[model samples]
Target: MNQNYSKKCAPRRLMTVTALAAFLFAPASASLFAQAGAAASANSPAADSARSAARAADPLRGTPSTITSAGNEARTQQDAFERSHRLGLRFYNGGADATCEVALGRICYWNNNGDVPPPAERADARLEREALLEVLAKAQRENPKDDWVNGMRVRYAIEGGQAEVGLEAARACGGTDWWCAALQGLALHNLNRHVDASAAFGRALAAMPEAQRCAWDDLTLWLDPAMHANYKALGCSGRGAENARVFRLGQPLWMLPGNDLQNEWYSRFTMSRVHSLGRLPYDMQWGDDLLESQLRYGWPTAWSVQNGGAADPRPPQVVGHEPTPSYDFMAVPSGIGSPTQATAKDWEPTRKKARMRYSTRYAAGYGALPHQFARFLRGGDTTILAGGYRLMRDLEMGRAPYTAALTLDGFDGRAPLQVVRDSAPANSALLVPFSSTMLASVEVLAPVGKRAARVRNTVSPLPRETRLSDYLLLQRGDPSPTPTLERNATQAYGSTEIEGGTTIGIYWEMYRQASPSAPLQVSLRATRLGASFFQRLGSSIGLSKALTPVSIKYNDNGRPDGGAGRSLTLNFPSVPSGDYQLTLMVSGAGVTDSTTQVVRVNSGNK
Candidate 1:
């Protein structure tokens, strides 16, 4: 029996020693078993049901489908509200006054998913208001002079559409602050106190930070009708008058290259009002002739409002009076209105009168027609007569491309009129006046080369042969000059590749009856690739003085027979290395033609 007892005690003692050794040497293994058991228990259905119930009580839980799910969601939200409310109370009891108020305020205005029913939204809103009021009451008791708290109160009042209350709260925070002043302005604006609101906005603007000034300006522009009216009343002289001036200049002038027209018009209009008419509201700065001239001409010169007065009270200063040579008689449509029923015969007398009138004005050193005389020229039936006289003069000069007669209905009778080009031999245009306040002369000229002589060239024979024929040479200076009428021709030459600053020789022949004494006007223009459309348009309008000018006199004095064949050479200016187009326009008595060739200026000689 003693041996048996000893054996059992030995086994028990040995087992206990083994367990202590395992705990000391293999502690991680023991921890793994415990974690595995806990994980198994956590994944059990009972544990899952408990977790679902907990999630159902959480207001922040994701929504689920079904009416029952929605009800559970509502209950969970209520539980969350209660929990926050209790937590806030505890914080308040613990003497964290500000923190407690903030917590309560957050709970009151808590934003829930918009899927909440209308009743729930209303209830939540009421709870929010109550909580905010509680926060305000506590804040007032704790820190009555705190601007942050007062600002919150003001924001809350404004959010609730209580403008008067918002104003009171803002005033309590000191009306000098930008935010406070802005709030006061909004409140006043809402209450129909526009003057007071404007003052408040002004104060706010004065105090606003530089970074936020633009936002303030935008707000003022949007909300203040009186500000807009005041700006408009000042015309071109007030603080914001630049915008009004731009609008009054109209669209035709804006389509030009730069802001020269706009600036000149504003200065002239302001000067006329202030200096000439003694208008009090005009800007005196615009009256200084030296400064005005510098601003307009970019140089110190005499101020002359009469410069562009021929077209309008303020015409584009860049518009030159140096008319195109008589041979280049293409007429541009002037933006003047005329009577719809007037005929060309009726305009003959007016044309004669205007010629005399313009000559007298020019001789007298009066730059442009006086305002009254210009108005007279643009008034009544004489307006149509003026336009008619222009048309007849163009017709008589053989400048009109189309043989169409002048009909009064085609002219849109508006400023910046559109002249439609038609293929008919009889080119006819109508002028229909919509307004009696017509602009000065609206000269309509046909495109150049419309009635001019035809210049032609052949490229297959090196040193291309250029000549005049019954038809215009549709392709002049072209690497491949193919006559419209197919005559035998060889291979077409490729574009000329020349080094920069080198002169290219152009060879062409003139086929027409010409008096030897008549000098031919030749214009050679080089257009670089990627040039602006406006630049190209200016070139077409005979305004491009950049072109190289050339003149060739046909010495027919020795030869009685009219000369038909002629050749000419032009030296172009040094051009940069790039792709370019060289256009040659040749004009002589009753003949005008143009040809273009592609030129590639290589960087270095190949």
Candidate 2:
């Protein structure tokens, strides 16, 4: 709930309280998908009218379905309509009329059906669903042009948490190809197949009318003001990262296969259009309140009566499928710098805090494994993204099937990035087309035991001519004196976190522009952060009381014409546990360059 949820809601009887909404799951339906299948034929007047309507003469489906089928088409439609009507009425258990009153942007005076009783538990819902689907399938075969029939078949399957069924229904649809594509997109989005879903949505948008496409393309419908404005100026038509960033990020908890947010957005669009034609529940205030309720927070997975007998918002709560961090939704992190740089603070916002709070963010259906990578200018204008990751979870004696994937979203248009997937290999190098300002999200996922970890961000391409590549940390125990991207992936730790008095390995490649074997002046230093006052004071002057900084300086020879670079196992057992900014600088042929990374050291006991 936002800051205005309590103040704006006037009537105590009807409150959009989280706990209340969480309890009541409203069960029933009141839409045309159940009854509005007009059973039209090619020459029928209804068919002609629907043909003229373009999108749909009337399109919708009622809640979860309790409609039945009869022997004849007309009788079946009538039976389904009557059954849904009864089911809708049963929402209040026995209400003759349910009243609606909108206030302060919420349902305020919902009191027509006096003393609203709790809705009865839904029973035989499966049987009712099968009957309704049978009728719709027959209707679909008979009148394939009716958009409602096609939409209901898919929507019902998706909402019921049956992804395969939803996909099949979407594919079997015959109305508008665009509509079918949109349906497929919805199903694919639910399954978290972002690339495929984006392709489907792209097809739908391509086939839609320009005006409709513009409406669908509007980011303002969901984004906060600041972000919306930012995206407005982005001119990013080729970026397909928006849906994954929004739907999954909006409710990342992978409890259900389908993304509730996507379906909710779809539902809102359908309701806005269909309700305008006047078939939905009347009570203008109720509609506004309900619409805003869904629009602002999210659509409810289910609704039910308040346990404490609250009268108003009557089925007094609307539970969201899952909550997104709305507090930060409206604006970017203030201290974060401009989005131009790959290393900007806003690039990977949740890293520091999340990694610190949780030992492993590999819970539920998602993960956050740590890894280090470096981009090298390979031949043929391709930048090779080389990295390795180590897993801390699912370390059983038996080797389980694992999939390590390097996914790069926003690759370009609807085409997916071509890369090989392996079963937890330590090190691999991928070649990608080079671009200076490419805002690509490169994710390295090597999940084990179904729960996996992934580290993703936009890495700026290496300069055309550079002195050295980024540091790749490795396990101090590894025997390989020279680090290669082809090492066993599970051997290196991505978390630069270490324990006090522990040694670790650092590896890097020297890109000597002059002679490959040129001798270079190399210096490595670890500066303690938040140093004690005495330590700072001691360092101000050259005195015996001053402590020697954790520093290592050496002269190193660069690699030969076709040689791999160099590495060192670093250990400072005397260095106290703290945060350190580890800097590596290399000077060769009078040109100097450097890179820095943060490494944390905890007490030995920890």
> Which prediction has the highest lDDT against the true structure?
2
lDDT (Cα, tens digit) per residue for candidate 1, span 1-606: 000000000000011122221111101011111133554674579977986676455322223432233233333443444334322221001111111100110010011111111111134544764456446434533543433344445544544446676667556554236655655555554444445655665676678676555432221221123345544455332434333222222211111222322222222222222122111111111223222222222221111011212443322111001001111111111111122322222222112111101111001111111000101012223322111111222233243453211111222323432222233232112222223332222222233322211111111111122333111111122232322112211111112444565543443334444444665665556667765677567666888523222233333321244433222334444544566766656677666776665665665422
Best by TM-score: 2
What local distance difference test score does each model get? 0.31, 0.47
Query: Model 2 — which ten-residue stretch has the worst lDDT?
Result: 352-361
Summarize candidate 2's per-residue lDDT along 1-606 as a digit string, tens digits.
111111111233323444222111221222111112222233368755764474332233322232122213523543464355334332223222332332323343232212333443255544565566677667666655555666665655654557787777777766677777787776666565655766777788798777777666554545544465566665546323554455544332222234444444554454343233222222121234455544444332222322224433333322112122122121132311222233323324233111101111122233344556656565444565654545544322124444455534342454434344555454333334554434333233333433434454455667666557677666653455455654523455555666666677776666664343566788888877777877777766754222344578887754445455567778845456677788889887678889888777667431
Estimate TM-scores for all models.
Answer: 0.20, 0.62
**What's the TM for model 2?**
0.62
Tell me how far the alpha carbon of residue 101 in candidate 1 is from the true structure, in angstroms, after superposition.
Answer: 39
Measured with C-alpha atoms, the lDDT of residue 479 in candidate 1 is 34
In Å, residue 422's CA in model 1 sits off its true spot by 60
Model 1 lDDT-worst window of ten: 1-10
